[model samples]
Target: MLIKPSTAIRQDYTGLAELCHSIDEPVVLTRNGEADLVVMSYEAYRRAEARVKLQARLIAADRQAGDPTALLDATSVFDRIRARIDDAEA
Candidate 1:
């Protein structure tokens, strides 16, 4: 959705909000004929944030996978985490 500055400023917010809720992509709000703010649904924002985080995690994991020193069995990792948690609790 492309919104002109005049329409965005003069129109009621309900229509804009409705469009945001219904659409999957972000609504671009233009000002002075240039790109301005972006409007998107809460769920869309959350999903995008999650995807970015997951991508970062995957990249980190890929880097670690190439480093033999960083490798560890799942059980040892869980045990180490549990020990840390127990130490913190104590």
Candidate 2:
């Protein structure tokens, strides 16, 4: 984890931005010696968001798999997913 004083941002916004882009990770900024905010490249934020979404989907799938009442045959599931994709494309 990269940690920087909040003053660092006010002092060198460009350098901080470059560090975020180069590291592809978040930089923690502290104020009064306490953690305050996190800064990251927009691309990194988007990737992190995507990972969270995928994890949620996986968890939901696992729960559904263990529930007999929610079970759906593989063919039906795939057909419904494909239909949704087709609709999205159209």
Candidate 3:
């Protein structure tokens, strides 16, 4: 999908809803040269909105939990995760 500039959208909003419905994500609502608004399907929008809310709650909970699992080093995390998958396969 072409990243639509905000000006063009503002001038031609007649078919915006139809276009938005057909596409997976909302047309990029740009302000100036930068993207500002994301257009997406209603279900996608709801899922995204819910995910953001869930993330905030999760973050607050983690903070309250005093950073549990803080020693998870990324370098070894993949190997650890892969080991779990290997065990599952076996």
Error of 3 at 72 (Å): 24
TM-score of 2: 0.80
When 1 and 3 are scored with lDDT, the better candidate is: 1
Against the unseen true structure, what C-alpha lDDT does each candidate score? 0.82, 0.97, 0.77
What digit string (tens of lDDT, one per residue) describes model 1 on residues 1-90? 655463663596787777778877688878788887888888889999999999999999999999999999999999999999999999
lDDT of 1: 0.82
The top-ranked prediction according to TM-score is: 2
Off by over 4 Å in 2: 74-90
Q: Which tens-of-lDDT digit does each residue in 9-59 have in candidate 2?
A: 999999999999999999999999999999999999999999999999999
Q: Candidate 2, overall lDDT?
A: 0.97
Candidate 3 positional error at 25, Å: 1.8
lDDT of 3 by residue, 1-90 (tens): 547777766777767766777775667778878888777678768887899999999998888678756656777899999999999999
Which one is best on lDDT? Answer: 2
What's the C-alpha lDDT at position 90 in model 2? 100
Provide the clash count, candidate 1: 0
Lowest summed lDDT across 10 adjacent residues in model 2 is found at: 65-74
- Give the Cα error of residue 5 in candidate 1, in Å: 3.6
